[model samples]
Target: MGALFFVKHKPTCREIDIVKLTIYTDYSLRVLLYLASKPDATATITEITEYYNISRNHLVKVVHNLGIHEFIITSRGKNGGIRLARPAEDILLSDVVRKTEPDMDLLECFNPKTDNCVISPTCRLKSMLYEGRSAFMAVLEKNTLADAAGPITQAKSGEAVYVNISRLKR
Candidate 1:
């Protein structure tokens, strides 16, 4: 038999990070997409909660945070509802993610103040983790919310409808 050599393939940053988004972040994105799908129309908190079948209380916080970030415009009155503050194409996926994800630390050693890892002082792992996170964000930087929202199909009745929200989670 000929000599065989094994090759080691390192996992990508996305693979290494594999960070689970918080429910808050999930809701925030959902709300943004919902508004994006209906760019000309405003959606109320109740409408979004009903469409997604999520808790109103939780969505309230998400909506509030989105408004604070100026991602959406909220009016309070008879016509009160939320709409995108800017065009969908103007909203960068990276910006939403960075604002929503409170911590981007891939490992315990990533944060100097909170890191208790003894190996952190001389650890190459920290650098690797940072590289992974950077790689992950780099992908997000290339796309905007419009790329994610895609085309919203209008039904025969002229009502806007968007299917496959699962794609937006990415």
Candidate 2:
């Protein structure tokens, strides 16, 4: 009698093609972009909510997280508002994505401690996914908040005129 064992197989590109950021991360980037455009002034959640037409409650949480991560500075009181903690040029897009994203694991096999897949031990898919993720992050690491914010125009009143966030190309 012989014992049977399972063989590991490499995943196809299509099998490991799922890569999507959470809405929270998207909102976090939006907040950063908005603040980057208004570098000289602070902005309130209400203003951002109105501009993006998103839920104020969701933005409040995003703002709090951004503050906690030191991505933005928050002030309290009558004149309170939020602004970038540092210059937009100094803030890396990769850092924001890492800070805002709760989980970056591309698949169940990426985390060894929690991974229970039979093929995880021998699978090449995890390595391929790791390479893909690394390439994606490398692109972000090369860019800063200022790069994503694009150009900031000024109105006749000297106020910063920003691109319409809602109408931005996805």
Q: Which prediction has the highest TM-score against the true structure?
A: 2
lDDT of 1: 0.75
TM-score of each: 0.79, 0.81
Candidate 2 lDDT by residue in tens digits, 8-78:
23223335543677678888988988898788899999999998898999999999999999999999889
Candidate 2: regions farther than 4 A off = 1-17, 152-166
Report per-prediction Cα RMSD to one decimal: 9.3, 9.7
Query: Where does the lowest 10-residue lDDT sum fall in candidate 1?
Result: 1-10
lDDT by residue (1-83, candidate 1, tens digit) is: 11111112232332353356666677888888888878888899999998889999999888888999999988999989999
Q: Which ten residues in a row have the lowest lDDT in candidate 2?
A: 1-10
RMSD of 2: 9.7
Residue pairs clashing, model 2: none
